[model samples]
Every structure is written in C-alpha cells, then in structure tokens.
Target: MTTDTLRASRTFSDWIPASWAYPETGATRDLRFDYMRGFVIPLLFATHFDFFSLLMFVGWERIGIVSTAEIFVILSGVVVGMVYGKKVKRDGLPATMPGLIQRSVDLYRISVVMILLVAAIRYVPWIDSTVITTFFDAPNNQTYQLYPPLDGSLSTLISKALLLQIGPHQFQVIGMYVVMFILITPLVFFMLSKQRVWLLLGISWVVYAIHYGAPFQSLRPTGAQFEYAFPIMAWQLIYVHGIVVGYYKQEVVAFFRTVWGKWLIVASVLLSLGFMFLTWNHPLPHIPQWITLNMIPAETFHYLNNEYFSKSKIGIGRLLNVVVLFISIYALLTLCWQPLNRALGWFFIPLGQASLYVFFIHVFLLLAIMNTPLPGYKDFWINTALHIGLLAVVWVMVKKEFLFRWIPH
Candidate 1:
C-alpha cells in the first residue's frame, strides 16, 4: 500500500471534538458566592427556629419579600453550575458523570442521616412537645408527617427510604437538589453537546409554567393528598437557570453591563418593590377598591391574596424579589467588593465555605435550644445570647475544620 493510503487507514487517537471540550475549566472561586451562602445559613437557621425573633422580623425575609430559602437554592444551583458544569465543559460528558453521581450519593446519604437523627430525637420521651410541634412535626396535611401515627410509622419509613416522602422541616430541600441533579444530568450533557442552552431553558420554563398553573405536588405514603413545600418541578427552573448562568458566566456578566441590562435591572427593582407594597399591610393611598378588594374580610383576603406572593410556591412576587436582590448585590459587589470583603468577610466567609457542615450542625443546635426550659422569645437577652452562641460555635467549627474536614464534601 502507498504511504498516504496507509496513513489514511490508521485510526485517529486522542482527538476530542470542539463541542465536547471547553477552552478552560473556568473554575474561578469567587468569595462572593461563599459569603452570600454563609450569610443565608444563619438566616435559614433563624427562620426555621421560629418566625418571631428579631432576626426573623428585621432580617433576611423581613427586609426582602423573598425568604432566605430562595437565595440558598439559587446559590446551590449557581455553585453546581460553576463546579459540575465547568468540569463537564472542560473534561467532556463521560469524565463529569461519575463525580456528579458521587456528589448526589453523598447528598442523599446526608439527607437520610439527618432526617433519621431528627426523627430519633423526636422519639425521646423527654423531648418537648414544642420542639416536636414546631420543628419536627410536618405540616397538617394528609400528604405526609415526619413522625406519623403508630400504624403509619412503617409506611412512612418505607416512603422516606425511597425518597418518595420528604418531611418539610427535614432535609427535603437537599433531597430535591439530589433529584434535580440526577434528572437533569442527561439533559445537561445533551444540551451541552448540541450547544443549545436556550433550548434547554425553554424546555425548563415550559415545565415551570405547567407546574405553576397546576403543580405536580408530592404525595404521601398513602397517596391521599398533595405536599407543596419546596415543590420540585417549579423550583427546578431556578436551579436550571443558575446552571445556565454559571456555565455562561462571562456572557451573563457582559450582557448585564449593557444599556439594556441596566434597564432590566432597574425595572426588576421597581417591580419587586411594587409587589412588596401590594402584599404588605400598608397599601398605597388612592388605589381603587376593586384593585385593593376592600369588600372582602381583611384577614381572609390577606391570607388568600398573599398566596399570589407565597414563599412556599415561589410565587411571582418572591421570584421577582430574588432577581432584583441578586442583580443589585451583583452590581454592588462589582463596584465595592474589596472594601465590602474587608468589612464583612470574616463573619460570613468561613461559615459559607463550610456551609454543609454548618447547616448539618444547626439542626442539632436548634433542637437543644428548643428543649431548654428557658423562655425562647420572652427574654430578649436570652434570645440574643442563643443566637450569638450558635454563631460563635459555627464560626469555630468552620475555622477549626471540626466537621469541615470530616464531612465527605
């Protein structure tokens, strides 16, 4: 055979398609992500502890229309996009799947362990009813209960084991993350291969729209009712959106800097504030009765009207609030990150960096505090001390790498 023919016959090796490989890993570690996440951990703890505390009243949720849970979930998505998406972009599909699977497995293990730990404590005879009622108890619905009746116990355990039933106060949010990662894996790789993120986003939004109109709610072990806490189908849109932004961080940043981007940012802020005004107790003067609906009983109307702005469903108001807050923070950080970092970095950085460990430990701390005979909210000094103590312990844990080193993350 001729030399040219012989060369042609030889199969090419180590040739990766451009579509399959990225220019760089794009693995930039931004402290802002950690700081924001760290900031939310304490707020999440406080919100879960109770809704009457000073932190609850004047802090994360109170200052903004959206709850800290929105921030937490969105940040989780962005980080997942940055970390896992970068790995996929850099190394190609096959190389990234194993790590993603492993990470999901680890999260699942943590979720189950935490749920069981909380359940075990609830079973203790001396445990206070207040703690059980407040934290461990599931919402009063036929859908599911964390500590079910005696007859329902075995079924509840079975359902939880299968992840078909996740209690509200437990690690249901983490379980949703695990589910999203697993479900989105194939689509992510396919979309990356096609280089059509918009198509992926369109598909995601369709699901979100459908779910919003009529949610595909979670079922109880008995399959009798719907559970809406952090509804997965609807919330996955935010997660997927984060992944898209994280994967295309450069493009997103560039777009945001443009004139159109600035307008959108301003509009988002205005819309968010408007929605807040509509939902809050104080409505604007001179608004029509039909718009304000003064005809309905105020309390009943407030409850029903607020459903349009509900946190549990990630309603329109909450979604807008998060978007505006995120854009505002991003802009602020771009201009003043250095000074801001210097001012508040120490407080949130460590906790943010070791968020998983801090989050896991906070549950135990919450239970202990609730079980104590002290007045939880009546004594201002005691309440302040409890928060300070929890913060200090978590700070030390992160700094000392107590569970930070031990945890698989």
Candidate 2:
C-alpha cells in the first residue's frame, strides 16, 4: 500500500478503538436499577390484581413475607439518594434542596391527579360505581377502593386538598411515598452534610420500633379503620437505610466482600429461611411430621395467622426477608452469566426507565379490569395472557419514552 494510505488507516484506527475494546468511563446508564425497577413493577401490578389468587398459591404472600411494596419504597430511596446525593456532593445542599422539593411536589401533584381521575371514573355510566368507592373500604381485604362521601362537605374537600385525607385504597401508597420523599430530601441531605447518617438511621429505627409496638392513628384520614395502610413511621427505616446504601453503594459493596459482611449475609439468609419455615404451610411437600416438628418450634409454627409477619405492619420477618432477597439478588446479578444478564437487562431496563408512566398506566388498567368484571378469572391461560399483554403493552409504550419524554429532568 502507498505511504499516504497506510498513514490514514493508522490515524483512523487510533481515533476509534477496536470492537473488542472496553471503555474505561464505565456504563452511561446502570441497567441494574432499571431492571430491578422493572421487576418490581410487574410484581406490584400482580399484587394489586392479587394475581387472581395465583400469587398466593405460588407462596409470594405466604412463605415470602416481603412484598413488592417494600421493594418499591427502598428503590425510590436509592434512586433519590444517588441522584440527589450526587447533586449535594457536587453543588452543595443549598442548590440541591430546591430541586429535590420541586420533584417531591411534582410527585404529590401526580398523586392528586391520580386520585381525582379514579374518583371521576365513578361517574361513567357503564362502569360500576361501587367498584371504585367500595374497593378501598377495608384495604387490608381489598384493592382499588376509595370513594367520596355523599355529603361532600367543604371540610372534607379541604382536608383532601391538604392531603390530611389521602385518596382511597391503592392510593395510600402514593401518599406515603409523597411524605417519605418530601421528608427524606431534606433529612438525608442534612444528615450527609453533618456526617450524621448513622444518627438519622438510629432515630428512624427507634420511630419504627415505637410505631410498630404501639401503633397509632395517622394524621391523614382515609375513613378506613386504620389511619393509613403504609404507616410511614415504620417504613421510613427502609427508606433511610436505602438512601445510605445508594449514597455509599461502592463502599457498601466493598464492605460486603469483607469477612464481617460475608458473615452478616449468611445470618440474613438463615433468618429469611427460618421465617419462611415458620410462616409457610408445608412449603416442602411430603415432609415427615417428625422433621417438621424438629425444624419448626411449637411457639413459632403453631400460629394460625402470620400477620405478625404481615406486609401491612412491615413485620420483622418481612423486613429480614427483603434484606436477604435484595442482597442475594444483587449478588446473583453480578455473578450471573453475561449473555443471560444482557438478555434480562434488554427486556426489563426500558420498563424501568419509564417506570413512573408504567406505574400510573398499570393502576388505571388494573382498576378498569377489576371493576369491569372481566371474564378471565377462572382460566389460567387467559390470566397468563392478560399479564403478558400488560407487560408487553407497557414495554412498547415506554420503549421510546412516548409519553414520558417531556418530563423535565
């Protein structure tokens, strides 16, 4: 080849690395966050729908004490912590606080709009009004129920406007999230600035303990017997701890490799298994009565109800189950085969990226399905198809950020 041709080829090669080269700048986006969020979104949808009792039969509720609700909350904390924590680290809290508050306000506004939309649906002639109104009556035993009083007094409207009365049923989680985000924005940043994260965490745990031990009425009124389903005082422990982890994710992961961290992981796994054994009903088929007797103590296994390990109260068993699951899942993701990881990431990451839109859309869809009395209740195949369609539709809608592209950073 001519000298000039050879020189040009060399220059172009230097400008662009070979296909095999791996860049040192790292990933532009962490697909793990999106994938995890995507994973939680379907589970959340299924829980809302009760998976037509399939989830119960599969032991998602019984043996697995932790619910997707907790995962969603913790993930929210992690995302907020990473995003706002970096901003605070870079620009200082003074500059970051306003944006944090603004984002919280945006979430609050979205929630209010959601509540109003659900309320208005009752007026549609074909749709069952009771479905919307009575769904949240006893949320522990129900889903998607919230209704405005017939009187609609000024006092009631005012309280609703102030969020002292959060909208019904599934909407309760939105309110808890609103409170958590607003409170954590300032609290997490301030704690970080003062290097008092541990102190903040300690206080959070104390509040959880007190709230769980002596449950109290919340300021918010939903007309349900309980003040709020989520009970923010206890759930905040998960939120705050998530923030610390997200803020110091690298450090935390490094610590997990240490002897103490490994031991802790082992303990967490064992505790989770013990809870499953105690709470589940014959999780392992055909086990000997003698073996069951030895594995599960009389005090632990004889209980009729597992509400002591319930999702509503954020029970101790539930908390430990999630901790172990979260850690184990994280470890598995890192250790999994590369091809499988890429495939899984490809499927879930987009849904996670557009999670906010997906969440809003799914709730509306589920509400319609539950209220309309759809025909697929008894058919396993139909239900499976419905779920697959739900995920597929959301995936397609969110793939290009169709409705969410305009959301401000």
Candidate 3:
C-alpha cells in the first residue's frame, strides 16, 4: 500500500456516504434506510388509493412478489436490531427492556386509535357509505374487513380493538408490529446479545414452517371474521432475518466485499431482473394489450402468484424475491450513493425519518380523498396529480415536523 494509493482509497471512501461505506453504529441515524422508507411511503399511498390511474406502474405487489409492506417490516426489524442490539451489547438485555416495552405499548396505542378512527368514520353522516362498501365488496380485500359492521355492534368492535385483534385493514401492519414488539423483538435482542444468532433464526424458521400446517388468524370478538391481514407466525421470518442481518451488519458488509459475496450479488441481480420481466404486466391498472409479454401463461402466473408468492402467507417465492431484490438494490445504492443522494435524498430522507408520522397521517388523507368525488373521476392526469399532491402534502408535513411533539414518528 503506497502512500498515493492509500490517499486515493481514502478519497474514494470519503466520497461515499457513511451509511453505504459502513454499518450503522447507532450513534447516528442511517440516511440510506430512511430514504428507502421514504420512497416506499408514496408507493404505499398509491396502492391503497386503488383507483389511481398510475397504479399499474407503482402499486403494491405489482413489481414482483414483493410489496412496500415487506420492505417496511424488514427495515423496521433491522433498525430495531441495530439500535437495541447495540444497547444490549453495552448494558445487557435488562437495560433495553424499557425501550422495547414502550415501543410495544406505543404501537398498541396506535392500533387502538386507528381502529377507533375507522369506527368513527363509519358513523360520520357526511362520509359516504361507498367508502366502506367499496372495500367490503372486493373479495380479495375482505380478509382485513376494513369496515366494521354498523349493526349496533360497537361493543364487539371496541373489545376487538382493545385486544389489538382488529383495526383498519390498511393499518393492520401496526397491530402486527405491536405483537412482534411484545413477543418477538425481546427474544431477538436477547439472542443477539448471547451471540446465538443461528439459534434465533432456527426458531424463527420453525415457527414459519408450522404456520403452513396450522395457519394463525386474528379473529374478531365474535370469532366469525378474521380481521388480521398479516399472519404473524409466517411474517416473523422476514423480520427475524432482518434483525440477524442488522445485528451482524458489519460482518455482512465485509462478506459482501469478498469474492463469494460478489458472486451472490451478481446472481441476485439476474434473478431480480427475471422476476421483474415475468411480472411486468401484472399491475392493477391495465396496460395496453399489445404491450404484453405472455411469457408465462396467464393461468400459470395466477396459480404461481397465489400459491407460491402469496403475501399473507409470506410464501416461498416472495421470500426469494425479497432477498434478491434487497441484495440487488443494496448493491446498486452502494455503488451510486453519492449521485443518487444528491438528486433525491432531500425529499425522501426527511419523509423516511418521519415515516411513522407519515403513515399515520396518510390514512386520514386517504379517507378524506375517498369521501370526495376525486376517486370517482379516475382520469390519468387527475390520478397522477392526486398522488403527487398527497406525497407533497406529506412531505411538507414532515418538513414542518407537524405534531412531532405529540405524535410518534
């Protein structure tokens, strides 16, 4: 290592963002993950909006087997591990217990509030019944049962909400997180502290496997309706894996710099592209008939997507897709962090930093939009404008730190 060579290395390394060049040390927030979360926020809004004209290009589960929900969950787990894993390492598991408990309680509170909000909306005279009916009518959307029945069953609804068993379908992930924080996250932190990472993963895999035979459901108080969207037993695999990777982030990064790691990155890139090509025409909004590939027969595609890549079950195909997509995207961002950051970091980083605030507020925005005639119009330009306008409003709210003092972000 000559002095000139060392100088060049230092210069190149300095040019890269710290988040890309090194693992998070929990001393400072990692902007890269925040940016990814920020990026996912609008996609989430677009997907939920349903009739948005540009949904085919940006909707959930449209790109491949993956969705923004998966990204959010995995990134959340990674962050929990990075932050609390470090704490456990320094002060032991007991010291980090309060933070975990507080987080779980906060998530539970949010879930309850969201459930109440939806219930309140159902009773609002000005808000049209169409808002509730639209979701109720959709067969695929029935799983979460977004709207509670108005048949004078407030007691059941409130009881379920208090139990964290039911909520707005869109906010179901929050309820799932409430459970994960309470039951799973502490064990993850403990295992990481004990350096029993493989043992933790083995247990997670076993739970995920069991979910296949005995699928868990979040039944309502009456036990007739399964209101939970995410099956915790299955989805925990992704979250647990994220915690392990985040706990060993430095080691993982080092491995990726090795020859075997480079090979794995190349393989991931190829697989991701293949998945994208297969699903290029699978989005909600219709593409021109002439633009179709027809590589996989329509029947075959549907069967594979439903059986092997199902979102609720966190199916095998989705599992594979997320891993490859993460690897490919992580590598691309690492290589081009400086250029990409300069171009888009300003907008996304702030939103990502305040993602919880955005997530909470966006639900209200969507509800308000639904009550209007805007979604009924469904013009391409109108839909595009609506999506951009919604994102900008959220961005401004984030910039102003709207309710930051009161609301958890």
Candidate 4:
C-alpha cells in the first residue's frame, strides 16, 4: 500500500524484503539487499565516496583530510557484495577451475576497461592531480615539499598503464582489484552456497592472525599514494561477511527479530565503543621501506618510503579500525530503528547496486573534467562543480544510451 519504489517503477525484477511485502505488486532485481552480504557494502561505498570527495583539496595534489583512504577504499570493495549477490545470480558460480579462470579473465577485462578510462582522463587538468606530478617529494620535508610532481618517469607511465607495479609515483592501481577478486571469489562463492561458513571464517581469522597482514606493503605502487592498491586480507572477512549475510536473508531477518540477536547487537556496540576509545590515541604505524630490503622483489629505484601502517601486528591501525567498522555496522542493523533503518535501506540499495560503475565512472568523469585546464579561476571552479554535477546528468542520460548505460545503477 506504500507509494515507494514497490509501486513507482512499472516493471521490476523480483527482489528484496520490500518486494516480499508486495509480492504480487513489485519485483526486486540487482539492488535488492540480502541481509548479511548486503548491508555493509552500500554503507562502505557511500561512506567512502562521500568522505573521499569532500576531504577537500589541500594542495595542488593531496587530500586535505586524514589518510584513511586505504582502509575506506578496501572496505568499499569488500562491501561490494550488495552487487555481487546479484551478479553471481546471472553469471552463475563458476563451478570448475576453468570456469572460474574464465570468469576472472572477463572481470579482468572489465577492470582494464575502467583503468583505461581513468587513464585517459589523466590528461584532464584539475581532475587527477597532474599538477602533483610536477610538484613535492615523498618524505615530508617540513622544510620543503616531500612529495613532488613526477611527470617525467617512464616507469611511472608504465606503472599507470599496468595499474599494478611495485614502484613510486604510479596511480590508479585497479589491476590489483581484478586480481584479488578473481582469485578470491570462487572460494568465497563456494563458501557462501554452503551452510557451514562460520567454521571457515573462524579458520580464516586464525590464518590471517598468523600471516603478515595481507602483505599490504604492495599498496600504492610500493611508495606513492597515487597507486593506492587496496588490501584484500584486511577486508577479506568483511567481503566474506557480505556473501554470508546476503545469502541467508530470511535467517538474518528472523535473528534480528530475536532476543539473542538484540544482545549480539548490544555486544557489537560495546565492542565498537571500546575499540574506538582505545585505538583513538594510538599512533599510525610507520613502515620502513620494506621494498628495498630485498626481502621483497622491487624496482631498483624503490627506496624506503615511509608509510603509516594501521595493522597492530604490523603496527597498522587498520586492524583496529576494521574491527570498529564491523562491530558498529552489525549492531546498527540488528537494532532495527525505523527511520535510520529505512534511510540505510533506501540509500544503500542505490549505492550498493551502482557502486562498481559509480566508482569507476567517478574517477573517469572527474579526471576528464579536471585534467583539461579551463580559462580562469572562475572557469576552474565551474569545472569542479561539474565534477559533482554531471553525475546526475550521466545517470539520466544513461537510460536511453546503451553504451552509457554502464554509468547508472
């Protein structure tokens, strides 16, 4: 009886809890939430994209805000199960290794397409921070610019093209995503289709605890922040959580409506609060140039670039942050407060469904506009506004245009 999407869209794909309420009247499709696998992804993307864009440009090249970009981006990718829950339906779980390998290749092609588009936009003026290529040194010399504009490196150029090289000053390391997803997804999907996922996850946590935290040293072209590759191990549990939660919506909904579930939510909240309080004052972990130690293979030019790792074991704070994010989200959803719940359901549905295209397109579109220099300061301002503005235009335009259809959710 509600006048929301269940009634608004004429033709719909069968999907979602909302659709369940109006089974005959509506259909849910790609964006439908699958409880567990579904919740955090949209939350993560909306959170990341909102924060990343609004952080404001401090210099010609860097973010004005704190550098949580690494964790945010990786979490965003893991949260992507809202989409994957739908994708795997159509694509089918590649049962055999051959099928999985083929699916990996296909996804690689998709990632490559996204990479090339972002790369082309590199020529655009204010978008990709090309000016940074001309300015700063990596080690902050308060006396001078620690990070400079490296517009002259062939290796850097090659790095961008490949999207996954262990060097400095490289950007848009999307290839790493392609690789991680391909290698990880098959097992992840297999786990999801089965009922005993908790057993596997417990083992995964132990495996992670013992190993080097996902070898996150590979993030950011070994040293440059530009090639910021997200860490898979850091958020692997989260991604698995996405799949687990989504695949068993009915059980999750029932659990949420239970007394014990309510307690779990409360416990999660307490855990989150405690974790944040303790970790807030902790310092960022500084990584010695792990690349040059030749404990790892690397570029000859790969000198030690100081990065603050957030894993407690490796001294990176991310381990704490991830725990905070996981617990807080779990508690929030389990509580089922109406208005807040409704808001997350609505926004997260769009954000989660549209995330892949949203992210890839955002980078591409912004770069296209910013990479090209405009006439004056006013014109430059307009270009920046356009960066935010054209998203609406692209969304509307994507409807009739098949090629651009990929732009919309």
Model 4 misplaced regions, further than 4 Å: 1-103, 117-163, 166-174, 191-199, 211-229, 267-351, 369-402, 405-409
Candidate 2 residue-wise lDDT, 1-409, digit = tens: 3454333223323443222221113232455666777777667656565544333343344435667778778877787777788888889999998898788888877767766676666567777645335554342555542555645665665457466353545545656777778866587779887888888888888888877777454433333212456777777888889888887776776676666776776676677666566555433332224323355554554353344565656778678778887775554444442444466767677777777777677767776776644434656556666676777877777776665744322
Worst 10 residues of 4 by lDDT: 57-66
Clashes of 1: 0
lDDT by residue for model 3 (297-362), tens: 777888888788878778899899989988887776665666678888898889888888887888
Between candidates 1 and 4, the one scoring higher on TM-score is 1
Q: Using lDDT as the measure, which candidate wins?
A: 3
Clash totals for all candidate models: 0, 2, 0, 36
| Local error of candidate 4 at residue 24 (angstroms) | 14
lDDT of 1: 0.62
Residue 295's lDDT in candidate 1 = 44
- Name the lDDT value of residue 75 in candidate 4: 44
Compared with the true structure, the alpha-carbon lDDT of candidate 3 equals 0.73
Q: How well does candidate 1 score on lDDT at residue 338?
A: 57
Runs in model 2 lying further than 4 Å from the true structure: 1-29, 53-59, 136-145, 150-155, 158-164, 216-227, 269-307, 371-373, 405-409
lDDT of each: 0.62, 0.63, 0.73, 0.41
The list of candidate 3 runs beyond 4 A from truth reads 1-28, 129-134, 137-148, 151-154, 215-227, 283-292
TM-score of each: 0.79, 0.79, 0.88, 0.53
What is candidate 1's lDDT per residue for 1-409, written digit by digit as tens? 3343222222111232222211122347767788788778768766665533445443434446766767877887788777777778788878888888787778767766765566556557887534432333233333334455434566676566556353435345666666777777557656865698888999888877776777335422223111346766677778888877777777886676566876776676676566455444323232223433244456654564466566656777577778787776655554445566778779888888877777677767767777776544566567656676778887887787776554644
